[model samples]
Target: MASWKFPGFLIFFTLFSCSFSYTFTITNNCAYTIWPGTLAGSASPRLSTTGFRLDSGQSVKLTTVPGWSGRIWGRTGCKFDTMGIGNCETGDCGGKLECDGNGAAAPTSLFEITLGAGNGQDFYDVSMVDGYNLPILALPKGVYGGACNATGCMTDINLGCPTELQVLGGNGYQVGGVVGCRSACEAFKLDKYCCSGEFANPNTCQPSYYSTIFKKACPRAYSYAFDDGTSTFTCKASEYAIVFCPNSNGNQKPNPAPASPPPPMRRPHPKGHVVPSSSNIVLLPFPVPMLLLVVSLSFSFIVERPWPVI
Candidate 1:
């Protein structure tokens, strides 16, 4: 008679898939305070807060579900009360600190994103369609695919804004003293610049004189209503950093990652077995190969019993 214990089974299994939450770290490098306003698209979840103040050199980290979509912009020169009511010189949303799904006012630099969009990709862009109030940059992290690229208006467009399109701030000022730049549509209100009526279609509406000025200043941003060829950027990234008034030193040095990373994604195992933190290996107990061997051996042993040696 021979006795044998079960052999240890070695199974190669694919790592369990986990759900990931995307992160957005908004940083302000401006010399003044900026009230960041956010608005979620239809079917998207609102962020932790709709609006908040970010002082110079300060930053805020926000986490959103993978499929969330939204837009963000800075509201300059805002005066808010204890009740969260306020007015902003630009990008005001209902005179409140929190936008609560309200869109920012026109002539505001816009950063928009659709996370985990079609085919697990993110579509993002900085648009001067409304206008330009501040410089912006969208930096992607852990990017995959060739589509990953940085997009934003790093230049201070207000400095070179045309006289007619310049939005002056503070006391009376001369050329090169503007704080914001108005889009052609905002400045002229023409059907062509506004992309309305006869010029509503892509073929009909084209970039205008004012739009050309903006395009030359901020080549990466949307200068007109249908400026999409180079304005929009796409990528698959784990996180993004949206910076306002990024330094123009051209160094583009790497900065430390945000202190808070999104929570680890998890998936429930069928057997309710918890995964060990130390290992990335996933074990499947009683795999098909081992189960079949056990069944075959049991049948052979039963057949060879010889009817109790009768």
Candidate 2:
């Protein structure tokens, strides 16, 4: 009986540990096919397949052990031969079908996550810091915490991307020759735009004109390096569904209306002072009651204003 007890306990422990593993259900809702790529962080384990073809309207589920950390992005306009040697229009990884350990190229939107162990909260975000290739929506299911809210960039930013920062697609690509939107850093390679060198810290680095455009279009996504106040999300989810080109269902939040004009570029404050920048503003959705109250007040103030004689 004593000998049997040890084996029974061991089996139970293995099963318990396995239960903590999480699943990522990647779906392609775009009209065309896209190859999804996965890149594990330096300290994390690689997934089963580094990359694979995901046809339109199809979905694939990948499992990850507890505490996994990685980034996933979609590759478009790929044409690989039998040998799996080829390139993609956007988000290519060393011109290969399987990324292996390679990361996605710039001008690619990324769904980045670090899963928690056991019941710990997971941190996740959809980042455009590299740039924008395709719109993505990440929805967490079976959330253990109250903070599990859907987040992603659902707007096709390429339509409004500046000419200088555009990535033109090849012969078969869509959207009038433009495909991806390059980051200011990718377009100019300046330390001020890249948030490197003298501007490495948040106090010294603020959103540039270009990043502000992305932030306005996709308020919940990471537009630049220091866009954490509104972009980062945390939850303890059993699984996450990452949908590429998500359809305009009611679940998806509509993009905010275009602002009158972007704020002027903010110069970094002198070092050692913690001045707040636009990137630090928390732009989360307001509760319905709060939103209504704000609108009512604004309307009342406008009505009360007296017209001045010209």
Candidate 3:
């Protein structure tokens, strides 16, 4: 009887733990290799890995505790030694292979998320507010219900990047071509572009010509500092897939996919919620009764099973 009790409790514990955690599947769908980096928010716990090399077509899974909040980005044109010491052409974090809590540099596409606690909706978005280094697509998987619309910027903004804001590839890899597109604020540090100083309020700060260019190209991505209305998304999902340089068709052409409709307006974020400058945060109650029922049934079956006496 004692041995059976221990096994039953272990099974229940495992299932309960799985119910609360969420999985992030990070994939490199680009033609070239990319090193992905992750940065946890000041209040959130860090993931198991801060960064790692991911070759084309490779995917890695990362699990996070409930309510984990962080940002993920890809670094391109990286050259590292045996000790993983080197820098990437774009999205480099302190010139190290493993970012180790370092945030990505400007001019990089970012996938930011603030996961909710048990049975709560997650807020996520692919942001170009920092700029655009590579195309990114974020898709939520295993959504129990509610609006789990896919959000991302698949357009290769570098091709049409304004000359002043273009980040040319200094390395020989992309010579004579733009490798990244800098935001107007990043290119020119002004009150209007940066949304700082007296222009901090949404009413005072408006979109610039450069921001319009990005918004027109990628309708779903966050083009500027306060692009929350159309850019932020919420979903109660078991997993999320963040694809870097996603190839929609069979080829490498960076064709944009049809934008998903904005999610229905929901309640505002709870008090004390940390809203990032580039995105507005929100939450929804997750349906956990069904999940709990399934776990309970499994636990009961395990406990009732007749065991051969040792």
Q: Best lDDT goes to which candidate?
A: 2
Tens digit per residue, CA lDDT, model 1, 1-310: 1232222121112121233456777877666778998887765667778899887667777776556766889888788999999787778899999898788886788888767643556667788788877878777776777435667776766666666776776622222456566777767767877888888766888777666666666666777666667666667897787777774222232231111100010111012112111111111221122232223223211111000110
Where model 3 places Cα greater than 4 Å from the true spot, the runs are 1-19, 170-176, 248-310
Give stretches of model 1 more than 4 Å off.
Answer: 1-19, 171-177, 248-310
TM-score of 3: 0.77
Weakest ten-residue segment in model 2 by summed lDDT: 273-282
- Candidate lDDT (C-alpha), each: 0.63, 0.70, 0.69
Q: Could you give candidate 3's per-residue lDDT for residues 98-132 as a string of tens digits?
A: 89888888788988887876566677877888788
Ranking by lDDT: 2, 3, 1
Checking candidate 3 for backbone clashes, the offending pairs are 119-286
Q: What is residue 109's positional error in candidate 2, in angstroms?
A: 0.2
| Lowest summed lDDT window (length 10), candidate 1 | 301-310
**C-alpha root-mean-square deviation, candidate 3:** 13.1
**RMSD per model, one decimal:** 20.3, 12.6, 13.1
List of clashing residue pairs for candidate 2: none
Better of 1 and 2 by TM-score: 2
Better of 1 and 2 by lDDT: 2
